[model samples]
Target: MNIEKARFNMIEQQIRPWNVLNQEVLDMLIVVKREDYFPAEQKSLAFFDTELPLPDGSKAMTPKLEARILEELALKKQETVLLIGAGNGYLAALLAYRARHVTVLESSSDLRDLAIGNLANNHVSNVDVVLADAFSFKHTGTYDAIVIAGGLEQVPEQLQKQLNTGGRLLAFVGQLPTLTAQLQTRTSGTDVSTRNLFETVVAPAVGAAPVSHFSL
Candidate 1:
């Protein structure tokens, strides 16, 4: 398959119709070159509307879903973003093109190395890939936005606390067959507003903060 043609189809056929109509995003998608991030063997599936496998039993989120999350975040030129699962640094590279900077936290050491290498190969300088467990990583400070690249069983309080006041988080919540892509934003004071973008399922996020038991 021709890479350019596949990319055009991905942007026009799958993403744009899903309300990812931002010109900047569409242009960025074209510029970033998703095919470069995939393994050389799997490069052909880079623009296909399917999840591509990673080294450590993980998978990259489908192109359409990634684009939808990008649209929902509504990234600004100077805003900082926190990416929970850095897979192959594909999404971070995309966010880096729009946001001022991106800090990616990944649990697997091998993935962390792959992400760093991929970002460097793509000349994506605005991203910092960290090897850490997402569930317990301390919120060194808040960010303008947070993106979870994988689905979660539940949103953890620590991750929620990392959001700067007025910051937004895009995540896939719940399990397969009933999962929802949710956009959560922190408003003034202590209010949080959530909107469901659509229904989808991707790989599950590992190392999320554990839920407390309430035994009576």
Candidate 2:
């Protein structure tokens, strides 16, 4: 397979058309080599416009979604980022390229280890992969940016509290039937502003707060 051609096609056909126009983000898509992070058997699906399944039953976001999230965060070179749901470390690898450092939280030990290994193989040294649940992990310091790699029924206050004033967060919120990708900014210690960027449904992160159902 012509790997370079496939990569280019992904950027032009899948990512760019989805409105991910930032030149830097488009460039990163080429530099990062998404195939490197996929399991050997699934490498063929790396450039396709679909979620790639991981060992722990989680799925990596599609190329367009990943690029869109990166564009929304607009990461800076000196920023510290907190990433929830480190599935296969592909997103963490992307974040690491744009941010000064990244701390990734993963509930599944198997996925955490896989993430560490994938990042290491790609020589991504700025990300720290941690085995911890996203909802319950206690952050030692606030972050300049935060991204939840999977969908959640709602954004948890615990995660929002970890964002520094002026920090930005990106996450997909809502149930399977409908979900919106929201960009939230911490305007002050107690105030946050949110804007919906797009609509898409992704599997909830493991251990995410469950959606309550009331049956009549």
Candidate 3:
């Protein structure tokens, strides 16, 4: 396969159609080599429109989904971001390119190690990878933005509390086949608002707060 041609096709056919129209984002996609983040055995599928498998029962979100989240976050050059789920560090590397600083939280040891190596290999220096369960992590200063790379049965209340007054967060909510990817913003006075970006399904974040045992 022609690597550049396939990448261009991925940007034009898969990502652009999903409303990733920002020239800056499109440019970053071109600069960041996705294949470098994939396992050698799966490098050929790096640009495919599906989640690439990872060891230890985890999966990377699809390329379009990664682009969509990046676009929706609308990261500013000086803004700091907190990313949940740093699988392979691909999205974190992408985020590092757009944001001033990124702190990524990953749960699995193997994935965390992979993330560090991949980010270094790409010469992405603005990201810090932490091995910890995202659902339980908290931030006192609040970040300019937060991104959950995987879906959750329901948004973690603690996670919501970590947002800065003007921060924005994007995550996939609900179950497979009908999940809605939502972007939420918190105002200066603490008013929160959300907009449904589009529907997409991703593997649920492991250890996300389980739903109530009995619902009304």
Candidate 4:
């Protein structure tokens, strides 16, 4: 397969139509070599417009969705980022290019090792991969941006508190069959503003707080 051609086709066909127009983001999508992060058996599906499964049942977000999140965050070279659900470290690799530093939290040991190895092999020095439950991990410092790389019924307020004032968070919120990809921005120490960016369904973050159901 012609990898470069496949990459271009993915950007032009799948991502661009989804409104990912940022030149830098488009360029990074080309440079990131996403195939490097996929499991060897799944490399052929690296650019496909669907979620790719990872070890331990986690998933890499679709290319267009990843691009959309990156564009929405508008990361700065001076900003620090926190990435939840660092499945295979693909998104963390992407975030590393834009932010000054990134801290990735993963629950599975196998995935944590996979992410660490992939990032190191790619020479991504700015990201720190930690094996910890996203819901229970305590952060020592706040971040300029936080991206939860999966769907959630609701983002816990405790997790939201990890953002610095003026920081932004991207997550897919809601249940299966319907979900909204929303960006929550910390307007102040105590205030947050949310804007729905698009609609998509993704696997839930491992160990995410489950939604309550009331049956009649």
Alpha-carbon lDDT, every model: 0.84, 0.88, 0.85, 0.88
Best by lDDT: 2
Query: Alpha-carbon error at 79 in model 2, in Å?
Result: 0.4
Which pairs clash in model 1? Answer: none
Score candidate 3 by TM-score against the native.
Answer: 0.93
List residue ranges in candidate 4 displaced over 4 A: 211-216
TM-score of each: 0.92, 0.95, 0.93, 0.94
Q: Report the C-alpha lDDT of model 2 over 1-216, residue by residue, as the tens digit.
A: 888999999999988988888999999988999999997788888999998888887778899888998988999999999998888899999999999999998889989999999999999999999888878766677999999887788898888888999999898887666678999999999999999989987887677876433223
Distance from true location, Cα of 33 in model 1, Å: 0.4
Candidate 1 stretches with Cα past 4 Å from truth are 209-216
Candidate 1: Cα lDDT at 62? 84
Candidate 2: clashing pairs of residues: none
The TM-score between candidate 1 and the true structure equals: 0.92
Clash pairs detected, candidate 4: none
Model 3: number of clashes?
Answer: 0
Error of 4 at 71 (Å): 0.7
**Comparing 2 and 3 by TM-score, which wins?**
2
Query: After superposition, which runs of candidate 2 have C-alpha atoms over 4 Å from their true positions?
Result: 212-216
Residue-wise lDDT of candidate 3 within 1-216, one digit each (tens)?
899999999999999999999999999999999999987888889989988788778888899988888888888999999998889999999999999999988889998999999999889999999888887655564788888877677677666677888789888887655678898888765577889889876777766854232334
